[model samples]
Each structure stands twice: as C-alpha cells, then as structure tokens.
Target: MKQVLSGAITMLAGHPVAPSTVYRLLAKAGWRKIVPRPSHPKRSGWSRRLKSSPRR
Candidate 1:
C-alpha cells in the first residue's frame, strides 16, 4: 500500500511520500489493517477426499 501510494504521490506531486503518512491517511479514511487466515484444514481436504472416496 505504502509503495503504491508513494509511487502515485511521486508521479502526481513530484515527491516521494512517507509510509507513516500513507498509513495515517488511510486510518483517517477508516481503513483497518487486515490479516489473512489460512484455509481450514478440514475444508482443504474435503474436495480431495471426495474425489478419492468410493462412489456410492
């Protein structure tokens, strides 16, 4: 996000933008940090097991 914003600022304003400034601006815009979660173990194997299991 910071890199993209920095590039955009550099392109538009002819100056680099600080990461802290980008984060601060996003915070003011009500954006929150997101953490990605790994897929659930059972769900991951469901399709594989279904394919390998004997057909009814």
Candidate 2:
C-alpha cells in the first residue's frame, strides 16, 4: 500500500492519502480475499470403495 502511495506521489506529487482510503478504494473496485477449501479425506478411492463394498 505504501509502495503504491510513494510511487503515485513521485509521479503525481499529489496529496498524501491514508491507508484506509486506499483500502476503501480497493473494496470499491471489487477486490476480495480468496481462501482455499479443505481437502476431502476420501478423495482418492471412491470408485475402488464402491466396487469392493458388499451389495445392499
């Protein structure tokens, strides 16, 4: 954030904007936090289990 501000200041020599202002701008621009999903425990062997299980 500060790096962007410093670069902008060097280019524009404009007034200093606060970090909160930059965060607000990013939110307004639709930036979002992405998170990873948890891995499934039985991910590898579904077909093997189905074939090996006894019939109902």
Candidate 3:
C-alpha cells in the first residue's frame, strides 16, 4: 500500500511521499488498515484435488 501510495503521490506532486503521510491521508479519508487472514499451505491443494477426483 505504501509503495502504491508513494508512486501515486510522486506522479501527482512530483515528489516522493512517506508511508506515514499515506497512512495519515488514508485515515483522513476514513480508511483503516486490514490484515489478511492466514492461509494454510497444506489446504491449498485440497480443494483442487477434491474437485478433480471421481465422484465415487
């Protein structure tokens, strides 16, 4: 998010913006941080295998 925000700010303002500035702007815009749910590596293939297996 910081990288994307920095790039956008640089393009719009002709300068690099810091991560804190990005967070501040987002907060002002009523945006909050979101953490993605944890994923299990072993479960990755389970759904594919179940779908491809014979319906016995």
Candidate 4:
C-alpha cells in the first residue's frame, strides 16, 4: 500500500492532490484491494508450496 501511494505521489508531484485523493481516483477507476486466497475450489496450497521449494 505504501509503495503504491509513494509512486502516485511521485507521479503527481506537481499537482495539489493528496494521497487520499489519489486513492479515491484509483477506486473510481475500478481498482480494488485483492485479498490472497485460493483462486479455485480444488487448489491445495501445500502442493504448490512444495513445488516452489528451492532445489538443493
């Protein structure tokens, strides 16, 4: 959240918009906060985690 806010501030530095205003604009544009969770009903996290493990 902080990284996104910081980038917005840098991009709109010359403007008089506040961080809150930038968030509002983003929301208006259909941006949403995504909560991490299984994208499918049958997707198990343990198998995915094991597959992502570093090979030794």
Candidate with the greatest TM-score versus the true structure: 3
TM-score of each: 0.48, 0.44, 0.52, 0.39
- Span of 10 residues, lowest total lDDT, candidate 2: 5-14
Candidate 2 residue lDDT tens string, 1-56: 54785567446746766667666767887887777756556677877688779999
The TM-score ranking, best first, is 3, 1, 2, 4
Worst 10 residues of 4 by lDDT: 10-19
Per-residue lDDT, model 2, residue 29, is 79
Residue-level lDDT of model 1, residues 1-56, one tens digit each, is 67887688668877777778778888898999888766555675778688789998
Query: lDDT of all the models against the reference?
Result: 0.77, 0.69, 0.81, 0.74
Off by over 4 Å in 1: 36-56
What residue runs in model 4 are displaced by over 4 Å at the alpha carbon?
1-13, 37-56
lDDT of 3 by residue, 1-56 (tens): 77888789878988777788888988898998788766655676878688789997
Winner by TM-score between candidate 4 and candidate 1: 1
Q: How many residue pairs clash in each candidate?
A: 0, 0, 0, 0
Kindly provide the TM-score of model 1 when superposed on the true structure, using C-alpha atoms. Answer: 0.48
Cα-lDDT of candidate 1 = 0.77
Report the C-alpha lDDT of model 4 over 1-56, residue by residue, as the tens digit.
74677576767786555677777877887989888774666879897788889988
Residue 50 accuracy (lDDT) in model 4: 86
